[model samples]
Target chain A: MSSQSVVFKPEISKPLLQEVMDRSGQNVLACYQCRRCAAGCPVGDETGVTPDRLIRMILLGEKNEAFNNLLVWKCVACYTCGTRCPNNIQTARINEILKQMSKEAHIEPLNPKVAAFHNAFLTSASHFGRVNELEFMSLYEIQNTRSELKRGGGWRAIVDKIKDRAKLGISMMKKKRLHFKLDKIKGLSEIKRLYAKAREKSVDR
Target chain B: MEIAYYPGCSLHASSELYDIQSRMVFRRMGVELKEIEDWNCCGATSAGKTDDFLAIALPARNLGIADASGLAEIVIPCSSCYSRMIVSQKKLADDPGLKNTINAELIKKAEGKIKISSILEVLVSKANSGEIAEKSIKNLEGIKPACYYGCLLTRFPCDVEIPDSVENPQGMEIVCKIIGAQPIDWSYKTDCCGASAVINDTDTSLLLMSRILHDAVARGANCFVTTCPMCQLNMDAYQEQVGEKYGIQKRLPVYFITELLGIAMGFSPNEMQLDRHFIDPFGLLTELKLI
Candidate 1:
């Protein structure tokens, strides 16, 4: 372990700790830095900020650094970290709050593709009141293509990606899993209203 | 025994095989699965991550419908859907403010009375009670399966409250034993399959799935079984891709737990939609003379 000392500044630590506690309903102070969460985390190797490190960062008042980590975006919400936490800290739930806050604060996500996919899913749900897998996949691909083009992957990368998706699509079709028709639940208007209410609440927050 | 059924999006579409097999297995065992009418999406992890209220509200709507239908318990076949619905119900019950807001918005009160259960939970209980054992028409002694729970089915012990250990659940193992199949002991049972990231981050999902598949095969599992359509989809459909990426010729057939149970309960391979699997299980079934 590096012997770098963290300066405990109450000025920064107090409010950040309170905000996290309020939003997550988890006490950062309860975490004794046990690293149990990290040990059980399935994507610990793939994440920029491991679960233990994230807790430490939050406790240390490294608010921006903790919130902006790619791990928050990449977390599959598998609850492995939460389940393994000896302190019952619910690290996965905390990560979820951090992700929501990150979105609200407009922190540039390290993984835009995942964010895009989420937006596509929400859009599909808002429209149909249920997820149309084919529609969601198409919307996700379109958003992914735009992101790839913006990242300068150019036309060839986009073409290759579409080709791959097309192959998968065909395979799913062959299995009769991919339906061409759009599916909507009966209470579309009720779902739309709920979305509107959620948006209002989100804006209020 | 009649139980409210919530098929969610995947069961209605991509994982229709799971729905068919589960219904068939339950019907054979004298259980009536009444599909919840007009149930909406459970919002899953995607919506849950985007907005907490929407996530809860989406499933809350389904709970309200189930509650109105007078079903005390709702059996969800998909693990992801079960997790969302259960978590949402708990959240709604715990927070009256959130529940009131959702109730006001949806024009339905989410009373949180309906207990959400995974199909595995329901089936395992039946197995433990000897209902399934008595119903098994064929022995599965030839098949060795690694029962993969993935994440959602038994994650977060406080929330899910599954019958077995959350970290190393044996609900499926119990079911396998009841049906006469040997369930292999293996790690990575509760490991994440990277879920929706399968679409957004294919490489990461492939790597994760490869690890799970490799672990199962290393433990001498001839086939893999799961309850979640998302997990089944990733392991079954993308097994080839992961094998190609890792340069391993691991071709373990993935089956929904219900499919295996249905087979043992005298349902034919065609009824179980075994051919619908991307990695067709028929060859393995033939090899084991299970067909």
Candidate 2:
């Protein structure tokens, strides 16, 4: 790794760091440039931003760099870096906060599929009080197709993907790994209420 | 002999083999798994990544239901579910004020403590007591498994520790030993499989999975077994893709820890749907004379 000299902007650091800390409850300021987290992160190499670097960006108030990075979207949330950190600074939690901030700021996600998958998971969970795998996958595929079409992706390619995935889905069903039933938990309204409260809290933030 | 069961969505859907084997093994041991009525998803990594309340409240609802039903303990077979449940529980234990605020916001009550156990933890616990050994009927001597703990089972959220060693866990191996299967030591046991990415960003998932599968093969493991549905999905279903993407040709069958335990309890492979995996495990079992 190479080091670069850059101006530290404390003026820009306050709001981002303050909100991130308040949101995640992680001590981002406690990071001492110990690259232990960097050494352990599985995607740091490919993403070009490690956990330590992400924390440093917040500490230095590089809002642009921190918000618009691949690591934020690509992080597996494996808790490996958190497990290795001496200060217990979990980058996964920090990434989650940045995701909320980015979405609020209207920054288009660098990875749409991951974003769509998370959205599908939440939507399925909120509706059914649990994830209906059949419903979730369908929702995810619709978003995926919409994004593909938006990117000027080929209809032929999209159809080909659908055909391939359909084969796999059918095979899994045959093996009894999948079901064709629509199901929900008994306390459905309670789950819906929780979702409503969470949405209101996020809007307030 | 009776306890709560939280068969998370993956268990109820994609990883039915794990769910079925868990029930079969536990039933043979005389431990009844009563699923908490109307249990909800714990939101896995998705909820926490977007909404803090969804992450906390979802798992808390199930924990609250278990407590209300007078069940003090629950078994979660999925590693992701276990992590979410235990992480939420730890938060309540660590901060009473925050717990009170969360409890008040929950439409359902979440005021009581609940113990969560991974199926690996349950299997190892039973193995430690020689119960698994006593129930064994098959001669499964030569079957060797690379005991993959994946990311969450051993290395839980920090400060929330399970009894197994974090860096190098032996809980699965402990169960394997009693059932006459050989469990191999391998690197990457606790490494991330880039699990969720296997859905959205498959190239990265393939790379991470190949690393784990290759390491297990190099370390002389004939097969792989884990309790995590997410990990099993990557390790088993994607073995062909992993091989094609990484130039690793070895195809090792992966099973849930409960599958091996069930076979030792004299359950047929067909009964456990062991052949349903992309990399069918029956060939390895047959070669080892385990069938």
Candidate 3:
């Protein structure tokens, strides 16, 4: 892949590089350019870089390429590559650390379709403190710019929504008879307390 | 012995069977579940994916709340919640700055200190499997179940040491065996079934679930058992979806490990909420003559 394909600049500072090396056991540089990690990865073909390429970029301090590649994000952390690695290198953990770094880097827009699930997940958690599958799906549909039914006169989307609504309605009805007792959660107050503490620390920093 | 329990959001709502069966089984085993009151979501995958603090705060808040409740170890049943709680606890525990920041919130919230542990750990380390086996009134006998860990159970193996090897977890299998069910060995035990992603994106979720189910069925597993509510929900709720989407006509039943244990312990279907499953588990239990 061309270096120009990356939309953002690299943040390969010495400290970041040191951190990666520290977590990866200095084995990131030990990769002899073997394609085994790439070959062993089931989803390698779908991402831009193979597991080997991802590690190489990190080893070379190409933080931008290492962080932005779909290879790091798409890895289900199945540990297949890590388990199969001849060097006993933990590729899955390394991939996750890189993904974390990528998030912190504030990369630009991903595919609009891909963003649907992420948005739904965040909206659900931000509001309910838990995932609401029905709400998440509905919100995703709306964000996709697709109505309850797909455009072009197809009724599939409408049917899906109708079915979804019925199920959701039934679920809510059943839930009403049960006592949720949300008040019993002891950590809510403490978490709020912790949040305030965190804010104060940030301000102090 | 009394212990702290974190019944994740699903257990209180969609996957109520897990909560019901867990409570019953724990009671039967003479274990006390001191529920952590007013606990929030664990942020699962969403909070972390969107914003680090959002995800961190979700689990961190719950952990702090559990801590304030004065529990030494929080026993979580849901794999997603379990992983997030333990990981977030470790993160906060290791980072003094983060802990100090959260502790300020703890001071305001009036909750005490807490540590996180999965129910697997609690049952294995504290409950004593020998006692559980001795308490078993009935055996699972001929039922062959696929022991599924999904993705979240042991993602960060360092934080927790579940009974089996993280790479090849056998805790549930041991529990299943003690109850008389045969644990089918398969490569997909730790594989990802795409978790909550299935509800939002059918394509990805189906593909992943199909792979898992296909592997289990191919290996002659009569039913699939798991420790996570989300995994159970996905596997059970989307059976028809996966079949229709993939053109497979067979029915694959999924059960929470607790439900099977509850059944083996001579609990009735009503006690385990077996009637509420999307894919009926009674047929399998009846076929095994455990009903």
Candidate 4:
């Protein structure tokens, strides 16, 4: 028994692990402490929490830690972890579930810009059956700037952001990459129904 | 034959060059691309992260359109849209209950009979048939390209079948080879470019992209060829920023796979809209005397 590392199974609360498993459809229990996911994660060093460690948090019923990690916000859904995992456990899906859980749990998002951009994207997708790139980016800019202001970011920061984005936008426009003409989808009512259905179903959860 | 084409949001504007070059090149290869009638966004990484049902329902709506149109197959250029479409296509096909639940809100009901193809897969098949090789007016023997697949081109849900090796993709290489371009086999072929976070988390995205660029450039790749609009934009539009952060002086041009194929097919830089890229995709071509 002394020859191998031992796992001290702390008294585990069933809710956190069960909820994540249910929502994400990933078998977090299948993780055997192999750090294959850790080595492959592009942002693991930056996030300070690798896929294996995050799974350990869930299995250990560390609800707050599971929902609040930077991995939950910064994961780009690269699928590298799932590709390399021996058990095929996808942390990207788990991160998505945790992001929603954090929002519902009233834990402030560690990365508000991601949240704001997501909201802007959905709002644009809902407004018109398709995403108007011009509308969505403008929406993201407004919400992101406001959030930064709320966080006490100085006007200087906002000005710098505007200058940076303006330069980027102008370059894109010069190349005819910016769509000045809006192209909305024809099935507008159908898209609205889908959004309404999603909201109604999500509330029931 | 007429093939259904789904451009998604990025293709309409930000990746217009890809759209233009694609139309031009496919026409040259004797294939007609008919745009899908008023397709919606696939929700991409944003929609799925925002709502699971929208992720499926959004793409399903388009699949429904294609299937209903009797276009047995549809081709997508963007990797993000292709992955979303194929993954959702597989999920809705396998689970009847989930399909029924999502279908109730749709104007067009998805029958789950349509096949989805990425533009890279389409080109590779054409290259194999000798159609693409026949159109090559100039031998692209001089340029060396790093075929960057990024994330979603070949990686999907575990159950879905991918056309190429997920770890080491050769679809771009296969097509480039047909046109006489030597494609570099690099380590960062499947690396994630921090695509969705390119804007919200700019620093992290740049760091990830820097690693990818570093490896490709180290391997002596002159330019990057990708099928994903997001990957191309991140590397092409923001390589200057990536250079500043990583202190790398070398600026490698990024081009769409279709654009590179267009170059070999005797289309000029202006015809291919090579100037649309921030890094000047034509610079390496002109320097190498390929064009």
The candidate that wins on lDDT is 4
> Can you list the residue pairs that collide in candidate 1?
none
Per-residue alpha-carbon lDDT of candidate 2 for residues B170-190, written as tens digits (9 for 90 to 100): 888888888888888888888
Q: Candidate 4 - CAPRI tier?
A: medium
Calculate candidate 4's fnat. 0.66
Candidate 3 displacement at residue A105 in angstroms: 7.3
**TM-score for chain B of each model, two decimals:** 0.97, 0.96, 0.92, 0.97
Can you give the DockQ of every candidate in the order shown?
0.69, 0.67, 0.29, 0.70
Q: Which ten residues in a row have the lowest lDDT in candidate 1 chain A?
A: A177-186
> lDDT per model, in order?
0.84, 0.84, 0.67, 0.86
Better candidate by lDDT, 2 or 4: 4
Considering summed lDDT, which 10 consecutive residues are worst modelled in model 1 chain B? B155-164
Off by over 4 Å in 3: A1-42, A45-48, A57-108, A128-139, A146-205, B108-115, B125-129, B157-163
Which residue pairs overlap in candidate 4's backbone? Answer: none
lDDT-better candidate, 1 vs 3: 1
- Residue B36, candidate 4: how far off, in angstroms? 1.2
Candidate 1 docking band: medium
Worst 10 residues of 2 chain A by lDDT: A174-183
Error of 3 at B49 (Å): 2.8
Off by over 4 Å in 4: A1-12
lDDT of 1 by residue, B214-254 (tens): 88889999999888899988888898989999877879888
Each model's number of backbone clashes?
A: 0, 0, 20, 0
